[model samples]
Target chain A: MGMPLELNTMIVTKGREKRVEENLFVLVKEGYRLYPIDIPIDVKKTMDSDSSGSAVIKKVEWENSSTTITYQLVSLNSTN
Target chain B: MGMPLELNTMIVTKGREKRVEENLFVLVKEGYRLYPIDIPIDVKKTMDSDSSGSAVIKKVEWENSSTTITYQLVSLNSTN
Candidate 1:
């Protein structure tokens, strides 16, 4: 099987405290949506983090499904 | 269309400070693997969080793709 094609990804390096509506729009702008109550959001987040780990917020669209969107957002992991 | 079949979801409500190796095993035990570096881990973490928010680890397997697992683990969001 081919790797899950990443249609898009957005990193929120600034403004972790922004409104949830704004954070949600970030995904809408990128042509993606939230992954729903299931799926592992934590693992997906780790994938987006850089070595410094300032990065947060991710939106992904799988290749096979046009309707399924993977929207992820983390509030700049406090450990950083 | 039917909802993305949730094959399995595991929640870890304790031991957030354990080693990464241990975390990886947590998923393996649940028959799940961490999603690649393109999915949203942050959002997944939030999904795992209960109203009290002590939960951290998550492991999920998609029904469509057995090999494609969604394993997530957050270090107990500090705010919680």
Candidate 2:
């Protein structure tokens, strides 16, 4: 048998006031043990002249520990 | 050099009235031309006794055309 892998996906958006908020999905798994892991932002970029996005993944805590990963998307202003 | 690959990510959610709604991301690319492609639902599942999720991808229209993939997440009732 192999270790289980938990997969999670999230879409982050900025509110009308430009406040950052995240809508998180409950941990979902197919055939692996589910564990909560934090994902770090691997990359961030702005696009479409309006939106900013970031990719994040949880740091690997242990060699055999289950991990959860998440990505955040946001909108950026031209000035910033 | 290899063909360009366009990547898009979306987080879909159900509204207060149990209506399915999707927050779409404008096409974002790293180093490829982006052509709008529809993503079909490949898999669907329910989790946490509350949320229903589905993975979708656009059918491969051409041998070397850019593709766009999207995943939709929605809340489900236990009855269905």
DockQ for the candidates, in order: 0.02, 0.02
On residues A2-64, what C-alpha lDDT tens digit does candidate 1 reach at each position?
Answer: 223333233332322334454342322222223432232332233355422332333233222
TM-score per candidate, chains pooled: 0.20, 0.17
Q: DockQ for candidate 1, please give it.
A: 0.02
Interface RMSD against the true structure, candidate 2: 17.5
**Residue range B1-80, candidate 2, lDDT tens digits:** 32234432322222211213463222211232222223333222222233344333221111113222232322333446
Cα deviation at B80, candidate 1, in Å, is 5.5
Among incorrect, acceptable, medium and high, the docking class of model 1 is incorrect
Displacement of residue A13 (Cα, Å) in model 1 is 42
Clashing residue pairs found in predicted model 1: A41-B41, A41-B44, A42-B41, A42-B45, A44-B40, A44-B41, A45-B40, A45-B41
lDDT of 1 by residue, B1-80 (tens): 32242332333324333334643423222222234332323322333564222223232332223323233344435552
